[model samples]
Target: MGYVKTTFLMAAMTALFMGLGYLMGGAGGAVIALVMAGAMNLFTWWNSDKMVLKMHNAQALAAGDRFGLVDMVAQLARNAQLPMPAVYIIDTPQPNAFATGRNPQNAAVAVTTGLMRSLTREELAGVVAHELAHIKNHDTAIMTVTATFAGAISMLANFALFFGGSRERLGLIGTLAMMILAPMAAALVQMAISRTREYAADKAGAQICGHPMWLASALQKIQHGAAQIDNDAAERHPATAHMFIINPLHAHSRDKLFSTHPATANRIAALQALAGTMQPNAPRMRQTDMGPSTTSVPKVRKGGKRGPWV
Candidate 1:
């Protein structure tokens, strides 16, 4: 049922894009706009991982340098039956993560320094597993296409207002109406489609983690941390907000109506309900099956305080 609704929403978004193009100039302009959108989609599909990583100034981590995190991601990928994606760490204090690539084989997962500092190892695994789920379910590709086309629609609407529109097409009233409503409609379509995809991804991510409570806990932390932090990159590039694990922008406070992510509370509630069905005593799988570690733990600094890694 969710899949069906998502398919319909995607179709609607495409239709809206094409219609906006038609309004901008007629058949020729619509064709040109769609062709450009297609070309951009293809480009973004192949290069979006690099683009996003650069946007956040994220640095790829070597397995030897961050062996623990690398090993955990590798183990999760093995369980998910996926190729291990390139991993990166962003310096931001926001506890968020996102996955990008055209497909599972080419994917990359990037998490913030804050996420590593804030989450327990188990909770961090849940977050990585959720991103792996995005790669597995192909949400990254779908979202890249949606973002590409939605931006094209907005571009076409702006073009119509400035260049393509003619005074004689209709009266002044018609021109005014098109200018006012076209961009709003395109934005509505983008938000509606993005929200649905987020829900589907959340469900798939919970399944991948196999313990919904981990994700519930992670979400609780992310929602609170994200609200306070400024993700400057996401702010500069608002079009990519839907690609994030959490909406990385702060501009939604005024309207709340335009947010691409579903309500955090609602998402947490669903995850909690899923957690209720799992056995409370289920043992968590380890990165290595040999046994628990007996080595001395490394020290970690938090809030200017020192502690042993737990």
Candidate 2:
């Protein structure tokens, strides 16, 4: 997402928060909610990275690890003209990755161990580049903040249940509907933004890596793995779903209004379009599109950089 879009999302989320407050306690509640929203925005700007990393149980990746993962990220960061971002490993079995921070200077890229086990070195670089694109675009700050807003909105919606009909201007029935609908509305906006940004990231990442097909190939593998394996952390904290390259909670092969990420096929198609120009006569990405149940990445190799880095 761009600065303009991020600003819009921030406004929309605060509005949702305030609207819920008004429903529960009238104008006075709206004032309080506005104050809370301002505080929350500032809080997320400073701390959302730490909160998200903690939420997923992400651990700092050992520097100069045997995987060469850290080194690869460093190289890519240089390629993207970005400062080195913190690298983290999430121990989930699902193959997915995300970037988080308030800005490019403080960003972090997190990948699952399952991702290390599933994607080739080139594919992993593609994923990292994609995340860097998000960091470079300042999408992480908004995304992390959005997750916090989404979660808080859900909580506030639930809190409305405790208020009697007379207390809420909406009354009991209206309160119940808002309780159900408010968070859903927030999620819809979250997903919509995610879908839009994923495409932009894919393009920028391809340019950063200088190989569109690499990311296209990785997306196919990740989509397949994500669909079959469970990401327990993501399921527990569903609000963070939009941060991932692929929605860790569920797999969607087609686009929909509420889907957290774009359809895998559509993303691949977009990347493939880039590949056509950058890599003339390159064979279409195929055969590697099957699920992880049927296929796994090649083992770490000693000589060249074709296999899994880990």
Candidate 3:
């Protein structure tokens, strides 16, 4: 189902690119746009993972250096029957994580520093497991490909604006209308695809962790933290915001129409409902309006400071 949606969205994005080209340079402009879009798609397929990681300035962590983090991820991968993937850390205050690569064999998982400090070991496992689920289910490949196409669509719109479009049949009015509407339409289609993939990842991640509550808790923490802190990298490169587990952008006041992720409240409710089905008597914390419940997990402290490994 994800693959199908990505395919449809990519097709729409590609068509949008072609439309922008036609408005800019008639048949000749479209020919150039197609060639450029095709070339970009090929390049992105091979290097998109690296591109995404680099965009966030993520650094690879050696197994020895990240023993605890690696071990947790390894255990979860074992549970999911997936091959071990490289682990990385992004030096950012935002509590977020993301998985990338074309396939599990070449995949990498990245977590922010704030996530390490904020979540418990069990909650971290739940989060890592969710990212692994994305790799295992091949969501990484789908999203990377979708992003490449969607990016090209927007690029084409920009190209149209810069090159003054084709001097074809469309007079002043049509040209003006196309320039104003094309990119917005492309963004809408791309956001729709992003929303669907996120929901699918949430469900798959919950299954991988075998504990929907853990991920629900992690999501609550990440969302609240993300809302407060700014991920400068994400805001500067909005194109990559969808790659993060949560929308890393700090533009929180925007309505759903302009936002990338689903409402945190809705996501938590869905997870709670999933938990209910598994164990009718499962322990649940009493959740407040938008925060985690009153129940708290004990913090592990080291050197008089709470640490992530705890």
Which candidate achieves the best TM-score against the true structure? 1
lDDT per residue as tens, model 3, 1-310: 8768877887887788877777778788789888987788778877877998999999888765643677667667877789999899988878899999989998999998878878876677778877988898787877776677677766665555456544345656665666667767877777777777777777767776677988999988888889898898888898888778888886463337767677777777887888777655432222221123223534655566444332
Where in model 2 is the C-alpha error above 4 Å? 1-9, 163-168, 278-296, 299-307
State which candidate has the highest lDDT: 2
**Range of the 10 consecutive residues with the lowest summed lDDT in candidate 2:** 285-294
Which runs of model 1 end up more than 4 angstroms from their true locations?
Answer: 163-167, 251-255, 278-284, 287-310
lDDT of 1 by residue, 58-156 (tens): 889777543376777777787778999999888877778999999999999998877776666666777888888888988888888877777776666
What lDDT does candidate 1 reach at residue 12?
A: 80
Of models 1 and 2, which has the larger TM-score? 1
Taken over the whole model, the C-alpha lDDT of each candidate is 0.73, 0.81, 0.75
The 10 consecutive residues of candidate 1 with the worst lDDT sum are: 289-298
Q: How close is every model to the real structure, measured as TM-score?
A: 0.86, 0.85, 0.85
Q: Which of candidates 1 and 2 is the stronger one according to lDDT?
A: 2
- What is the C-alpha lDDT profile of model 2 across 43-76, one tens digit per residue? 8889888989999999998767777778788888
In model 2, state the lDDT of residue 268.
93
RMSD of 2: 5.8
